[model samples]
Structures are given as C-alpha cells and as structure tokens.
Target: MLRRWREEDKEPFAVLNADPVVMEHFPATLSREESDALAERVEVAFDERGFGLWAVEADGEFIGFTGLSVPRFTAHFTPCVEIGWRLARSAWGRGYATEAARASLEDGFGRVGLTEVVSFTAVPNVRSQAVMRRLGMTHDPAEDFDHPVLSQGHSLRRHVLYRIRRRK
Candidate 1:
C-alpha cells in the first residue's frame, strides 16, 4: 500500500538506507542521521508539492518506500518526474516495489495529472532496471548518459533511462 511517511517510518528507513546491498548502486550508504534527514525532506516535498515518494506498507509493517520524485540533477531528461523505490533486504523478491510503483504511477497520471514518468538507474543495476521494465517503462539506448552528479569515470556514472507516458 502507498501512503505518506509517518514519524514511525524513520528508524527502519534508516537501516534500509544503510544496507550495503541496498546502497550498492548509489554513491554510498547513508548514515542513520542522513536517512532521517532524507525522510524529513520527503515529508516536506509531499507538503510542498502535494506528492512525493510514499512510505510503503505490507503485512502491516513499514517495509520500504516507492513513489515519484523530481531528480535533483540536470540530465537530458531534466524537468521530469521519476518513479523509483528502495526496499529492505527482507522485502526483496516480493512484488512489492512493482506493486507500489504501479499505484504511484496511477496517482501521478490520474490524480496528480502528470503526463510522463521516467525511471533511471546505473547501467549495472539490472535489478532496478528489471523493475522499471516490469512497470511497462521503455528504454532508449540512445538516451543513456553519465550521471552528472558522479565524478568522471565513477563506476556507476553510466545510467539507463526509461520512460512511460500516460495512457490516453
């Protein structure tokens, strides 16, 4: 299920952020303090924008998060809303991320009225790329690029971009 983050979500989210497997694609794992700050930012984004990455619940527990957010860096796809997620190791192998992301896309295209949602990941992140494809998003090899935020030659700098347009 998809909903806004509560104060209760902070601790588990912090631990999720610190997991090496979960943080492998990003620059580094966040400290607990950093993760809490990120949760604060997500809450603020929802308040300011009326929507952001939603806290996910399954089996009555806060497993992880999935939803839409604006990418903070400049890319060929600047000004796009992107669908993404991060789940705890315990939550992997379930359909949760795909399911939550579908709800998020519905909210984006239905209630939020966005026309297109983009998702991207480091080139080697086949796991996330697979989720993106499962969301019915399509990629263009021509659209791949080095992430501007990563230093030159960083291992994960190269990224694949996928996009799904709102249905008529």
Candidate 2:
C-alpha cells in the first residue's frame, strides 16, 4: 500500500538507500543522514505540491516508496511529473513497484491532472527500465540525455528517458 511517510520508516529507508545493490545505478549509496534528509524532503514536497513519493508498506511494514515528483533540473523533461520507486532488496521481485506506480499514475492524471509523466535512470539500470516498460512507458533512444546532476565523465551520467501519457 502507498501511504504517507512515518517517522519509523526513516531507519529502514536509510538501510535501503545504503545497500550497494540498490545504489548501483546512482552515484553512491546515501549515508543515513542523507537518507533521512531525503525523507524529510519527500514530506515537504507532498505538503507543497499535494503529490510526492508515497511510502510503500507491505504486510503492514514499511518496504520503501513509490510515487510522483517534479524533476528538479533543467532538461527537455523538466517541469514534468516523474513516476519512481525504490524498495528494500527483500521487497524486490514482488511487483510492488509496478502496482504502486500504476496508482501514482492514476493520481497524477486523474487527480493532479497531469498530461504526461516521465521516468529515467542511468543507462545501465535495466531493472528500472524494465519496470518502466512494464508500466507501458515508451522510450526513444533520441530522448536519452546526460543527467545534469552527474558530472560530465561520471559513469552513470548518461540516462534513458521513458514517458507515458494519460489517455484521453
């Protein structure tokens, strides 16, 4: 289930962020302080935009998070809502990301009234690309770009962008 963040979720979320496997696609694993700060930012985003990453719970336990947020950098896709997810390794392969992402898309299009949502990850992060595909998001190689947040020579700088539009 996707829901609001809880204070108890911070520890597990930090653990999830610190997992090397989980952080492989990005620059590096987040330290506990960084992870906690991210959680705080997510909470603030929801308060400001009325939509942000929702904490994912399974069997009544906080597993991770999935939801929508506006990308912060400048790009052709900037100013767009993006669907994203991150879960504990134990929670992997459970279809929770897809399920929660579908609900997020519903909220984005139905409630938030967004026309499109986009998701992106490093070129090597096929796992997330697969999730995007499973959600029926389309990718065009021509749309790929270097992630602005990553330094020019960073290995994960190049990323693939996927997009899905709300059906009329």
Candidate 3:
C-alpha cells in the first residue's frame, strides 16, 4: 500500500539510499542527514498538497518511495510536475516501482487534476526508461537536457525527457 511519508520512515529510506546498487544511477548515495531532510520535505509537501513521495509498503515492509513532485531544477522544460519513483535493491525487478509509479500518475492526473505529467532520467538509466515506457509515457527527444544542477560534464548530466498527457 502507498501512504504519506512519516518521520519514522527515514531510517528505511536511508538504507535504501545506502544501497550501492540502488544509488548507482544517482550521482551519489544520500547521507543520512540528506535522507532525513528529504523525508521531511516530502512530508511537508504532502501536508500542503495532499500528495507527494509515498512510502510503498507490501505486507508491512518498506519497499521504497513513489510519487509526484514539482520539478524545481531548471531544465529545457522548466516548471513541470513529474512522477517518479525509486526502490531498494531488493525491490528491483519486482514490478513494485512500476506499480507504485502508476498509482502516482493516476493520482496526479485523476485526483490532482494535472493535465500532463513528465519524467526524466539520466541518459544511461534504462531501468527508469523501461518503467516510463510501461506507464505509457512517450519520449520527447527534443526536450532532452543536461541537468542544470549537475556540473556540465558530469556523467549523469544528460537526461531524456518523457511525457504523458491525461486522456480527456
């Protein structure tokens, strides 16, 4: 089940970030302080917006997080909302990311009334790309960008954008 993040979730989330395999696509593993701060921000967003990165659980285990976030970083396409997800190494290949992310998209387009949603990943992150495709998102290569927050030459700088519009 998916639910809002809680303070108690920080430890498990930190563990998720600590996994080398899970952090491989990311630039670096998040420090415990960073993970706690992130969880606090997610909780605040949920309080203000009614939705944010949700704690994904199955039979009372913390799988990871999945939800919608307003992209704050500058991009070729700025000021867009995005649906995203991340899972622990143990959760990889289990369809949990896809399942939880689909629910996030549904809530974004259906409940939150967003007309469209976008997602992006580093150019080499095929796992995320596959999940985006499974969610019916279409690539817009023209919108691909070098992530502004990363150094210009960073290995994870280039990203591919994917988008999906809600059906009328």
**Model 3 per-residue lDDT tens digits across residues 87-151:** 87878898998999999998998889999899999999999999999999999788899888898
Off by over 4 Å in 2: none
Q: How far in Å is the alpha carbon of 101 misplaced in model 2? A: 0.5
Output the number of the TM-score-best candidate.
Answer: 1
**Ten residues in sequence with the least summed lDDT for candidate 2:** 70-79
Candidate scoring better on lDDT of 1 and 3: 1
TM-score of candidate 2 to 2 decimals:
0.98
What's the lDDT for all of these models? 0.94, 0.94, 0.88
- Which tens-of-lDDT digit does each residue in 22-95 have in candidate 2? 88898999999999999999999999999999999999999999999888899977888899999999999989
Model 1 lDDT on a 0 to 1 scale: 0.94
List, in order, the clash count of every candidate structure: 0, 0, 0
lDDT of 3: 0.88
TM-score of candidate 3 against the unseen true structure: 0.96
Residue-level lDDT for 77 in candidate 2 = 75
